[model samples]
Target: MMLEVAIKHAFGGFSLDAGFTAPSGVTALFGRSGSGKTTIINAVAGLLTPDEGRIASRGTVMLDTHHRINLKPHRRRIGYIFQEGRLFPHLSVRQNLGYGAWFAPTPAGRQDASRVVEMLAIGDLLDRRPGALSGGEKQRVAIGRALLSAPELVLADEPLAALDEERKAEILPYFERLRDEISVPILYVSHSASEVARLATTVVALEAGRVVAKGTAAEILGDPAILPAGAREAGAVLTAHVKTHHPDGLTELEAGGIALFLPTVHAAPGSRLRIRIAAHDVMLSRERPEGLSALNILPGTVHSVRPGDGPGALVALDTPAGRVLARITRRSAQTLALSSGATAHAIIKTVSVAASDVGAAAAT
Candidate 1:
């Protein structure tokens, strides 16, 4: 296990009781504001001690109320990447990163500065100060500094919340690489479904300070019922591989022998990718629909149907690609008579599959 947390804590009118096990790779702590995402992170970081519980990582005990074992924050060997890059004003980028390496309690395992700089692609910014760097560049530097410390775990509390969409796009790939190539397990906390669907290998969703759902990203991202007000935009993550790109501005992707074409992706052929087909963007038909302008039509069987409070209903399909989700009106479902084990077709537009949702599998 990468991390094990079981705790009970409180603050005035509020109370927290949560526990989870983070496996290797990235484990996402998903919840809305005040759902105790940061509170759990603080407990693991030693910034906030739980009234009673045990926190351990990779066979090393961090906190145990029974044994009265509580390690100091520095002694815990954990790295933290905050929402904002907090760098020294006067120090150069290289100097700031070296500062983190200097305090390596275990210098034997300390990461080489040159390797860390190259991993984050910050070699050119070494001589510059923090004030002269862009928001994305500063965040990359912050990540490199944390890696230099050779921490056991990495805690990211909405690390991209401060960046605009453009900056977020610029740095997302580096994070993907960090999760794939690096050995450290990341406990990522986020409220956005897209981020969790993209980067997380496992998801432990929380509500009211308690875990409501936990599983692989495919299982959690496909079910909208557990998400807080995320049903309208809920979707499923499909593992795909690039087949080829054509001059007509379309790229073909394969998943379980099913071909999916979308807007041109710059990634080379044969690269693995993940695609999220939004439920609302998917349409269903009892029979294969023809004479339509839509480029993608997947044949599948209806697995289940869940009705929402309003006119919406979630239809799950077992397609060749994977378990895809479709959102339609209850009336349409009744008119089409969609039910468990019913044969159906899922239709999606080429333009609806956004580039952000389709990312390289190597980056995963």
Candidate 2:
């Protein structure tokens, strides 16, 4: 599914003139607070009609102000999951899920209760009421309810924002499963960088109600100029296959003949995984450093250097492992005589890598 949007609207003191395209899988509408993420979503949802614009998904027009086409929210075949689950406190989980089926204009053609329960791992909580469930469980029920409606698209606006870190981690893999296994496209809104790194397939980045960038997760995240930490946080995404697990609670992965050691991941050998390496954590050496504790060192060459706003520079390298980025001081780069096509080695300290930044499953 492809979603195309162009909208113009003003509320209070905020004016939103934004547009973008979203491909299949999970497309994240990412920006800081009040950047018009919710405003654009509301327009597509038919909750707030834009002053002028077109919103189309897979050739179906959800809103076109010029043509006067506006489908009612219920008739749009779009499921919505808010930050709060919004499940009925008085209803059992089963009944709440059944309510989703009842609201569909057409029968979902027999609800797959068991399938949903198993997929979300909510079978045990099926008999409980919303008040009796934990935050993570309630969110799972909300997701199941949305899926039971059999929507062509699902819009989630900061669905994980209300949860604590542990709860967020608990619910994230289920989202990954939904992204990998479900057929419907999802439009997710979030401001957290970690959430975008973990769940987005395409990223539509916005700032102050305008689109700053839009593309695949790797492309957007790898651009140093656009990252929050500027050159410091810019990094590369490597697709690897699990090779084997070490007895010391670490897993070794192979990508293009290069080996990487990660703090034990859940995938079995041969499973493909995408790993993110931040530029700040990488150091470049002209010759292989001796007696260093850093475990992963790969041969590479300087690809290019982009000047930054201050003392540091964004250096891109083509490594045997894949692409690796490094942020080095101007003096360090000059002393090393780093230039395009210069052969070098990227020294990555495995211990410097944060466990939370390593995504074990698919990322947006």
Candidate 3:
């Protein structure tokens, strides 16, 4: 499934003008609060029609100003998952999921409840009420509910914002399962950098109601300049597979020909994972340094250098593992005579790779 949006609307003092094309998989609508992220979602959902422009999904027009084709919210067939689960308070998990199927316009297209339950791991909660479940379990049930509706598109507005870090971690794997296993395209909204880095296949970045950037997660997240203001956590995401578990309490992962050692991972060998390497945690040198405490040293060539207004500069490097970014002082960059196409070695500490940043079972 694919979604195309191009619209402009005025709401009191805040005007929303945004556009982007989202292909199958998770397309993250990322921006700070009040960047019009929710506004665009509402437009696609047919709750708030745009003053002008068009919105379409899978070649079906949801809204068109010139043609006056505006589908009602229910007719749009777009499932919406709010920050809260929004499950009926009086209903059991099974009944709540059944409600999604009841409203589905096409009985043939309605997703099998058993399949969605297995995919989201909500089978155990099927007999319980939403109040009896944990935050993570509630979100999973909410996702299952949306999927059972046979939606062409699923819109999630900061679904993890209400959960604490632990609950967020617990629920994220289910989303990864949804992104990889499900056929429906998902429009996931989030302002969290780590969430975008770990979950998004494509990123649509908004700033003050405009699309500042839109591309694959690797392209958008790898460039610090495209990140939102105060987004100092800008980094590159590399695809790697678990290679082995050593007796030393560390797991070995391989990306391309590069090796990454991290604290013990629970996944079995050969499982694909996405590791996020923060630019601030990386240091680039003109040549490979010797006798360094850091265990990672990858040979690479300088791809680009972006000097910030402050004393820092962000540098991009093409490494064997993947594109790696480094944030260093302007003086350090100048001292090393760094420039585009220059040969350098990226220095990274294995310990700097956080266990929480490793995505499980994510497609490459």
lDDT per residue for candidate 3 within 243-262, as digits (tens), equals: 99999998999998899888
lDDT of each: 0.87, 0.83, 0.88
Per-residue lDDT of candidate 1, residues 24-85 (tens digit)? 77899987788889999999999998899999998899999999999999888898999998
* Model 2 segments more than 4 A misplaced: 11-15, 108-111, 228-233, 360-364
- Candidate 3: lDDT of 334? 94
Better of 1 and 2 by TM-score: 1
**Against the true structure, candidate 2 has what lDDT?**
0.83
Question: TM-scores across all candidates?
Answer: 0.96, 0.90, 0.95
Rank order (by lDDT, best first):
3, 1, 2
Model 2's TM-score against the true structure: 0.90
Ranking by TM-score: 1, 3, 2
* Clash count for each candidate, listed in order shown: 1, 3, 0
**Backbone clashes in model 2, listed as residue pairs:** 199-364, 200-364, 201-364
- What's model 1's overall lDDT? 0.87
Q: List clashing residue pairs in candidate 1.
A: 272-361
